[model samples]
Target: MDCYKKSNIEDLKAKNSYKIDLLDYSLFITFFPQLIAGPIVHHKEMMPQFHSLLNKEKALINWEFMAKGLFIFSIGLFKKVFIADSFAAWANAGFTLAQNGGTLNIFEAWVTSLSYTFQLYFDFSGYCDMAIGLALFFGIVLPINFNSPYKALNIADFWRRWHITLGRFLKDYLYIPLGGNRVSKIINLRNLFIVAFLSGVWHGAGWGFVIWGSLHAIAMVSHRIYSFLAIGKSFLNSKIYKIFAWLLTFNFLNIAWVFFRSENLSGAINILKAMFGITWVELPYKFKASWLFREIGGNDKMVGFILISFIICLCFRNSIQMLDNFKPNIKNSIIIMLFLYIALIMIGVTPYTEFIYFNF
Candidate 1:
C-alpha cells in the first residue's frame, strides 16, 4: 500500500519506498493494542511512527501525554467492566432464552433488545477507547472508531459515527471501486446494498448477519429515497418532528441489533415478535427469573443503572470529546486512579467477559 501510494505521486522525482523488514512487519501485525479489533490501520499510518520511535523516545516522557493516555484508559476500563459488563449480564441471558425458544412478553422482549443495544454500544466503544488510550501511551495516535452514535437523528448520521474506521475502509476500498455515487442513482443504491451484504459477511457467516445487513441496506435506501422525495423535501420545522425522527432512528437501530446479536434468525424473529407486540402477553407473567432484573439486582437498581446509562449515552459528551479538553491535574489524576482501581477490582483476573468484537 505504501509503495503504491508513493508510486502514484505526481512528482517526477520522489524518495523511493523501501521494503519493510520482517521484524518490523511482525511488530505491526502483532501490535497488541489493536490486533484483534481495530481502528483498521494502513501501513502509511503506522510505519512513520515506528521508524521515528527512537528519535521520539526521549521526548515521550512528557507528563501530559502520559496523564491523558492514562485518563482515557481508565475511563475505557471503567466503561467496559463497570458499565458494559453490567448490561451484558442481562443481554446474555435474554439472548440465551431467545435462542432456546423461550417465550417472551413485551416487557421481556424490550428489556432484552434494549439491553443488547446498549451492551454493544458500550462494549465496542469501550474497546475502541481502550485501544486509542493504549496506542497514545506509546505516542501512536489511532483513528477514532466510534462517536456517540446513539445521538444521531437519522440512519445515515448514525452510520457516519458508528464503526467509523470500518465505514471509511468500506467507502474507500469497496464502495468507490464499485463506482459509488458517480453512477446513476439506481446503480448507486445497488452498490450500497452490495457493500452492506459484504459488510455482514465480513462480520461472520450467519443468516442473522445477512438479515441484519439487509435490514440496514433497506433503511439506508429508504433514507435516500426520503431525501429525494417531494414530501420529504418540505421542511419539518417543529422540534416535535426532530424528536420523532430521532426516536424512529433509535428504535430502528435497537430493533436491528436483535438480528446482529441473535444466534439464529428464528431467535431474532421470536424476540421481534414480542417486541412488535404480536405476542403481547398482557397479564404480567412471572417466571422464577423475571425479565426486568434477571441476574443483576433489584428492579430499582436495574432501572436506575439503565436510566443513568441513557443519560450518559444521550446527554453527556463522549470520551473522545472530553479528551480534547483533558488537562492533567491533581483532580484528574485522582479520578483516573479511582476509576482504574474499581475496574481492576471488578475484573480480578477472571473477567465477566472479553470485548465482543474479539469474536469478529
Candidate 2:
C-alpha cells in the first residue's frame, strides 16, 4: 500500500499537484469486492467514480440485470468448482511429484503445464465474469478481464489482451513513470528491469516470481530488439508467425506457472529441472486412475471434470454469442433446460475451489 501510495504521489508530483493528500487514494484501493482480486482499477478510472459515489443516490437493484448476474455467476461458480478445481489437482500433483525428482515424461510435463494453464484461465476468468456480472447488476461497467489471449499474434499484443487492467496499470503507473521508451538506451533498460521486478513482487512475496517477471521483461526487450532491426514484423504477420507466437506465449506462461506454484526458490528449481527431464529416478507406480488418486493431488472424477470444463471454456465465447443471437423458440427452451440440468449436475458433483485471482 505504501509503495502504491508513493507511486501515486510521484505521479501527482510530476503533474505539479504534490499538495494532494496521499490518503485520498485509499478509496481507490479499498473498494471492498476488488481489494483482493482486481481488474486493477487505475486512479484515473477510479477517482471520478469515487466522487460520483459520494453524490449518488442509493443504487437501485434492477431485477433484470440481477437475474442475469445470478445466471452468469452460477455458470462461473460451476466453472471454478467443477472444472478449474479438477485441473488444479492434476497440476498440483504433477508439480509435487516433479519436485521430489520422481520420473516425469514429456507427455506428463506438457499435460501438467496445459492443465495449470487452463486452471489459471478458468479460475481467474470465472471470478472476473462473476465480478463483472455483479457490477452490472449494480449499474457499473467493470472492465473486461480475460479476452481470447490464446489467440494473440505476439507477446506485445498478448500483454494488451491478457490481464488488460494490470498491463494498463503497469504501463501508466510504473513503465511510463520510469521513462517508458523515451529515455536514453541505458536508462530504458534499467527502467524495464525495475518495472518487471516490481511486477513480480506485486504478484507475490517471492524471488521466484521476481525471476518470472524478469523473464517476461527479457522477452519484451528481445521482441523490441527484433522490431528495431525490422526482423520479425512481416514474418510475424504470417500464419506461421502467429502459430509460433501462440506456442511461445503459452509455453512461456506455463514455465512461469512453475515459479508461481512452487513453495520457494529451491522448489522452483526442482520443478524446472524436472521440466527439462533432469529427474533420474522412477516413481514406484505408473499413471493409472487409482494411482493418480493415491499419489496425485485429486481424483479421476476431478480430472475428467476439469478436462471437460476446459473444452467448454475454450468454446465459451461462441456459446455466449449464440445465446445472444438465438431466438426464443422451442430450440432455445431445450437448450436452456439442458444448461439447467448441467448446472444441477455440477452442483451435485463438483468440489469447490476458490477463484485463483482472490490471492492477487
Count clashes in each candidate, considering only residues at least 3 apart in sequence or on different chains: 0, 0
lDDT score for candidate 1 against the true structure: 0.79
- Number of colliding residue pairs in model 1: 0
Candidate with maximal lDDT: 1
User: Candidate 1: where is the Cα deviation over 4 Å?
Assistant: 1-19, 230-237, 280-282, 285-298, 349-351
Q: Tens digit of lDDT per residue, candidate 1, span 259-358?
A: 9999988889888998788865553345433444453222555566678988999999998887887888888889999999999987984357988998
Candidates' C-alpha lDDT = 0.79, 0.63
Candidate 1, pairs of clashing residues:
none
What is candidate 2's TM-score against the reference? 0.75
